[model samples]
Target: MSGTSPSVAAGAGQLPGTGRTAVVTGASSGIGAATARRLAAEGFDVVVGARRLNRLEALAASIGGRALPLDVTEPASVAAFTAALDRVDVLVNNAGGAFDAAPVAEADLDSWARTYEVNVLGTVRLTKALLPKLRASGAGDVLFVGSTAGLVSYEGGASYTAAKHGVHTLAETLRLELCGEPVRVIETAPGMVRTEEFSLNRTGSQERADAVYRGVREPLVAEDVADCIAWALTRPHHVNVDLLVVRPRAQAAQHKVHRDPPDRTAAR
Candidate 1:
C-alpha cells in the first residue's frame, strides 16, 4: 500500500511520525537508545524505559521524551511503566541479551534460565501488559529487536539462540493473533551488531569480546538496526513488513562471515 495519500500529504507537519507516541524498552543503551533518538527526531512523542533510571533520564532530557523505570522481568515494574503512559502507538521490545555462549553439553542451567527469563518471559510479560494500550491506539506497531541467532544455530550459542528463537516465534504468533487488527507485528533480526555492552556481557571480558570481532572489517552498529526499525515503523499503516533481517556486508549468514587478516601491527 502507498504511504503517500493526499490526506497524509496535506497534514500540518513535515514529519510523518507527527502525533504518534512510541514506547521503547531497554533504552539505556545500544539499539534501544539509538531508536529513541531517531523516533524523537521523526517527531514522535518518545518515552524510553529501562532499569537504569539515570541514563534513561538523561536520554529523555536530551530528546524531550519521558523516562520511566522498567524491568520487564518484574510484574510490578511493567505495571508501573504501563500505568505511567496514557498513549502508546508503538512498542519497541529491545531489552534482551546473550549472557553466556556455553555449548549444550556444558550448559549452565542458571545462565539458560536467565537467558529465557529476560529474552522470552520478560518480553511476553511487558507485551501482554501493554497490548491493551497498543490496541486502543487503533494503528499500533509491536516491533521486536530480534537477532540472527533466532533464525540459525551455531555451536556454543544454544542458550542465546534458543531464546532468540522464542522471540522470533513470539513475533510470528502475535502477528497471527492480531490479524485484521490495526497493529502490526514487525521483527528486525540483526546479525553481528557490535554494541558496547553486548559482546562484553556475553563473553564476560574485554579480551574475549575483542576476539569475537577480531578480523571483521566492519560490523553492524546499533544505529544501523535502529534505522531499520524507524523505517519499518514509519511505513504506511497498511504495509506490514513481516520480517526484516539485517546484517553487515561482511556477514553472509550465521555460519559465514568475511573477515580480514588480523592486524598484527595494531596489536603490537
Candidate 2:
C-alpha cells in the first residue's frame, strides 16, 4: 500500500456522518480511535466503544460521536454494547492485544486464552450481534484490524500469532459465507506500527515498547491503517477489498526490518 495518507474533507459532514452509522470497538486509542475519527469526518455517525468510558467520551466529544463502555471479552458487555446501537453500517473489530511475549514451550495458558478471547471470540460475538444491522445497510462493511503476526509467525509470539491467525481465518470465512449478502468483510494487517499503547500493553514495559521502534525511521502509524479502512469502505457497493497487508517500507516482512544506523544510515 502507498504510504500517502488519504485526505479528509474540509469540515465535518463535508461528505455525509448522518444516515450511515459506524461502530468501532476499542476506540479509546490507537488504530480504533483513529478509525473512529476518520469515519466521523467522512460523515458517518460514529459510536466509539471501549472499556475506558472516560477516554471514549473524550474521543466521542472530539469527533461528534457517541461513547459506549464496552469490554469485548465479556458476553454481557458485548450484548449491552450492541443493544445500545440502533443501526450499524460499519463495524471495526480492533479490540485486541498480545498479553506476553513467550515461545510455545514457555507459554502462559492464561495469556493465550486471554489473547484468543479478546481477539477471536470477542470479534465473533460482536459480528454475530451486528449481522442483522449490517445486512440492513445494503452496503455494510465489517473491518478487522489484524496484524502481520496473523499472516506470519515469529519467535516468542506464539499466543499472539495464533490468536491473530484465528482472526484472519474468521475474516476469510465470513467473507465466503456472506458472499451473496450486501455486507462486506475486509481485513487490514499492519506491521511494525508505533502506537502509544499497543507495545506497552503487549510487553508491559515502557523501555521495551520504546525499543520496538527505536531505530526505525518511520513505522506505520494508526492513521495510516485507518485511511486504508476508510478507503475500502468508500468503494463501490459491489467492490470488496478482501485483504490488505500494510507495512512501512522499512519492514519488508514480519522478520525483516531495516532500522536507521545511528541516525547516519537513515538514508539507507
Candidate 3:
C-alpha cells in the first residue's frame, strides 16, 4: 500500500490501491477515463469499459490494464462485460450523461427516457450484475459517478435532473438493503464539471458547451472528480463514504452560479 503517488486530490497520496480489480464504465473520456488512469496508478488492476472499443483499448494500453466493450444501457452487453471479469473489487458506475437543456414543458420524452435509461437503469444493471462478485471479494466497493443535478432542480434540466435523482435514490436504497453485506456503496455528486463531451452532447454544439464554462474561474475538471473518487476508494474497508457532493467555488448552486462579473473581487 505504498508508492510514489501522482499529484491528485487530498488523501489520494495515502495507501496505494493494490491487490484489487476496479471496473470503470464509460471510460472513453472525461471523468471515467481519468478515474481509470488514477486507479491503475494507485495499484489496482484496472478494467476500462465503454462502447467505443478503440478508445477503450487505447486507454487500457496506456494504463497497462484490460479493456472490455460495454454498453451499460444494453443488458446483453452488460452481461458480456460481467462475464469477462472473474473478480470485481471495485465497480465505478460512470456511464451516464445529460441529453438536453430544455424546460419540462418543452422536454422531449425520448431524451428524458434516454437520460433515465443510461443514468439510473445503467447503474442498476451493472450493480446487480456484479453484486455476487463484489460480495465474494469481501472488500467490494460500488461507486456511482453522480451529479449535482440529482440534488436540485433547474429551469431547463428537468429530464437530467429527474434521472439523476433516480440515481440518488437507487444508491440510497441499495445501501440500506445491503446494510449487513460486506460491500460498501458510495456516490460522488459533482457540480459544474467542464468536460468536453457532457455540455457539448447536451447542447449539440461547441458554442453552447463553451458558453457553459465561459469566464468561470477554475471550474471542476475531470481529473478533480477522479481524484475524489480515488481518494474515496483508497480508504480503509470499514470506512464507507455514502455520498460526496463536490462543486467549484464559483458554483454556489444549480441556479445561483456566480456567472456575472467573473470574479466577485473584480468589482471591488
lDDT of 3 by residue, 1-268 (tens): 2223432212444435667899999999999999999999888899999999999999999999999999999999999999989999899999999989999878799999999999989889999999999999888899999889899988899999999999998899999999989899999999999987999999999998988887777899999899899888877777888999999998988876776564663553
Candidates 1 and 2, the one with greater lDDT: 1
Which candidate leads in TM-score? 1
Query: lDDT of model 3 at residue 71?
Result: 94
Worst 10 residues of 1 by lDDT: 1-10
lDDT of model 3 at position 87: 92
lDDT of each prediction vs. the true structure? Answer: 0.90, 0.87, 0.89
Evaluate model 1: give its TM-score.
0.95
lDDT of 1 at 13: 52
Clashing pairs in 3: none
Error of 3 at 157 (Å): 0.2
RMSD of each: 2.7, 3.5, 4.2
The weakest ten consecutive residues by lDDT in model 2 span 1-10
**Order of all candidates by TM-score, from best down to worst?**
1, 2, 3
Across 131-249, the per-residue lDDT of candidate 1 in tens digits comes to 99999988889999999999999999999999999999999999999999989999999999998999999999999998988888779888888888888888878888899999999
Measured against the true structure, the TM-scores of the candidates, in listed sequence, are: 0.95, 0.92, 0.92
The order of the candidates by lDDT, greatest first, is 1, 3, 2
Badly placed stretches (over 4 Å) of model 2 are 1-18, 263-268
Q: Which 10-residue window of candidate 3 scores lowest in summed lDDT? A: 1-10
